[model samples]
Target: METILKIENLTKDFGRIRALNNVSFTIEKGNVYGILGPNGSGKSTTLGIILNVVNKTSGNFTWFDGKTSTHDALKKVGAIIERPNFYPYMTAQQNLELVCKIKGISKNIIDEKLEAVNLLEWKNYKFSSYSLGMKQRLAIASALLNDPEILILDEPTNGLDPQGIHEIRSIIKKIAKTGTTILLASHLLDEVEKVCSHAVIIRKGVMLYAGPVDEMSATNGIIEAKTEEISLEELAVALEKSPQISSANVDFDKVVAKLNTEVSATEINKFLISQGIVVSYFEKRLPSLEQQFLELTNNK
Candidate 1:
C-alpha cells in the first residue's frame, strides 16, 4: 500500500500541559483510518496537528503524494474539525455554494457534491430546518467540494440519532468505495469497527495501538459454548480448570471464555467431551473491535 501520511515522534504542548506525546503512525492511501479515544485523550488535538490547524511544540510529519502542510498539500485534503460553521438562515445549497466559492471550485460542482451526500432533494432547505443528520451531510458536502484526495472528519456522528448515524455511516462507506482515503476521529467504537479498515487508539496523549482493525482483534481470542445438561456453574468451573482458558464467565445459557492462545474449534470440542461433559455446541467467537478497544485502553 502507498503511504499517504506519516507522523514521526509528533508532540504538542500548551505551556506545561502536553496535548500529544511522541505520537507516530502512517496512513495508507485508499484506507479508512480511525483515530479513537475517550474524551480528553488527544484525538482532536492529533487531527488538528495533522491538518496544520494547530501548532506542534515539537516533532514533525510528512504528507505523501506531493502533499505537504502547505497550500498545495492542504488543497488535496478536506476536513471538518469540531462542529461545522454555516449560516443558519442559508439553504443547504447556499451553504455548499459558499464553501465552493471559498475553495475556488466551479459552481457546477455544488449540485454534484450535494447529490453525493444524498442531499440534492433538500438542497433548498434552510440549514436550521435540516435535522442533525442532514446538517452533517451538508458538512460532508462542503468538505467534498474540491474532490479532495483525503477526507478528515472529527466526531462525524457525534450527537446524531441512530438513524442519522446509520445514514452518515453509509455515506462514508460509499465514499471509501470510491478509493478516497478517509481519516475519522470518533469515540463511537461500533462506528469505527464498521467503517474503518485500520485504527490508531490513543490515550493520555500517547499512542497505544495502530494497525489493521482485523489484526488488532485477532490478537485476542474469544470462545462461546453451550451445553444442554450442564449447569452454567459447572461450565464455569470446568472452564476455569482448563490451562488454556484465561478468563471465563457465564451469561444466561451461554459460557463465554477468553483463551491464552488461539485453539482449534475441534480441540476445544474434544476437550469438553473428554471432561465427561456433553457438548451441545461449541464455537470460537471472533473478537470485535469493541473488545480489542477495551483490552487496549483498560490495560494497566
Candidate 2:
C-alpha cells in the first residue's frame, strides 16, 4: 500500500498544556481512517498540526512519503477543521464559484462537485435558506472544488440531527467509494464503527490503540449457547470442563462461555456432543465497537 501520510512521534504543546504527546500513526492511500476519542481528547489538535494550521511543538510528520513540500502536498488535500463560512445571501452555486476563484481552479468542475454531495439540485438555493444539513453538504462541495486526492474532516457530523447525520454519512461513503483517502476525526463511536475501516483511539492526548476496527472486538472470546437436552446449570458445568473454555456461566436460559485463543463455536459443539450432550442453540458473540471503546478509554 502507498503511504499517504506518516507521523513519527508527533507531539504538540499549547503553552503549559500538552495537547498531544508522542502520537504516531500512518495513513495509507484509498482508505478511510477514524481518529476517535471523547471530546477534548486532542483529535482536533492532531488534525490542525498535520494540516499546518497549528505548529507542532515536537516530532515530525511527512506528507506523500516526504516527496513534496507541505505547501505543494496540501494542494492535493481538502479539509474542514471548523465550521465553514459562507455568505448567507449567496446562492450555493455562487458561493462555490468564489471558492473556485480563491483556489484559482476552474469553475468547470463546480457542477460535478455539487452533484457528488447531492447538492446540485439546490445549486441556486440561497445559503441562508438551506437547512443545516444542506449547509454542511455545501461545505463538503466547497472542499472538493480542488478535486483533492485526500479529504480531512474534523467532526463532520457533529451537532446534526439523525437525518442530517445520515446525509453526511452517505456523502462520505459515496466519496470513499471513489477511492479518495479520508481522515475523519470524530468523538462518536457509532460514526466511526459504521464509516471507517480502521481507527485510532486517543484519550487526553494519549494514544491508546491503533488498528483495524474488527481487531478491537477479536481480542475477547464470548460464546452464547442454549440447550434443551440438558439443564442450563448442567450445560454451564460441562462447558467449563472443556480445555478450550476459560469460564462458563448460566445466563437466563443459556450458557455463556469465554473461550481461549483459536477456539471456535464448532469446537465447543464437538466437545458437548462428546460429553453426551446436544445444544439446541449456539452463537458467537462479537463485541460491538461501543463496548470495546468504553472498555479501553475507561481503563485509562
Candidate 3:
C-alpha cells in the first residue's frame, strides 16, 4: 500500500518538559488510524506538527511520500485539529458556502457533503440553533468541502452524549466508506476499537505500541483477583515467587499478576492455594484495551 504520512524520530520539548520523545510511525492509505493516548500524551502535539500549525522541537515528517510540493501535498488533507469558528447567525449552508469561498472551491458540493453527514435536511438551520451533534456534523462537512483525500480529526466526539457520539461515529464511518483515509486522535479506547482498523498507543509523548488494532487488542496475560485467607501483600509475594508469573502488584482490595503463559492461570491458582492462600474467586480473563492503555500509561 502507498504511504500517506511518515514520521521519523519525531521529538518536541517545551523547556524541560518533553512533549514528544522520538515518536515515529507511518500511516498508509485507506486506513482508519487512531492515535490513542490519554490527555497531555502528545496526541494533539503530533497532529499540530504534522499539520504545520505547531513547530516541532526536532525530527521531520513527509506527506504523500514527497511526490508533490508541500503546499500541494497538504492540499490533499483536511483537518479539524481544534474547535472551528462558525458564525452563529449563519445557517449551515451559509457557513459551508463561506468555507468554499475561502478555500477557492465550488459552492456546488455543499449539499452533497451535507447529505453525506446526514445534515442536508438541516442545511438551512442556523448554526446557533443546531444541536451539538448537528454542529459537529457541519464542521465535518466544512472539512470535506474540498473533498481532500485524508481527514484528520482531534477528539472528534470530545464532549457529546452517548447518542451524539454514536451519531458522529456513524457519520465518520459513512465518510470512510467513500474511500477517504482518516486519522483519529482520541482518548476513548472503545471508540478507537470500534472505528479504527489500526491504532498507535502513546504515553508521555512516547510510542508504546503501533500495529493492527486486533494485534494490540490481543491478550497481555493479565489476571485480576482477590483472596479471602491471605493478606494482599502476602498474595503478591507468593505470586512473585512463582516461576510462571513475571510481575505482581497489589491495588488495594485486589492482587493483579501478569502470567508468563496463557495457560498458567490454573498454575497461578494452584500455587497460591498451596502457599496457604485461599483462592476465593478466580477468572482467566484476557486484557482489555482499556486495561492495556492503563498499564502502559500508569506504569511508566
Flag regions of model 3 displaced more than 4 Å: 14-17, 102-104, 176-179, 216-259, 262-286
Q: Write the per-residue lDDT of candidate 2 for residues 128-240, one digit (tens) a residue.
A: 99988888888999888897878999999877899989999988888888889999999888887787888899999999888887886556567888989878999999989
Error of 3 at 139 (Å): 1.3
Q: Higher-lDDT candidate among 2 and 3?
A: 2
Candidate 2: lDDT over CA atoms? 0.86
TM-score of decoy 3: 0.77
Count the clashes in each prediction.
Answer: 0, 0, 0
Which residue ranges in model 1 land beyond 4 Å of their true spot? Answer: 65-67, 217-220, 226-233, 250-254, 278-281
* Local accuracy of candidate 1 as per-residue lDDT tens digits, 1-300: 788788889999988899899999998988999999999999999888878789988888887854554555776778988787789999988887777777777889888888888899998989998877888888999888888879999999888888988888898888888989999999888988888999999998999989898887544477778888878778878877788888888856788888888687777667787898886767797777877888788883
TM-score of each: 0.89, 0.82, 0.77
* Highest-TM-score candidate: 1
Clashing pairs in 1: none
Q: Give lDDT per model, in order.
A: 0.84, 0.86, 0.83
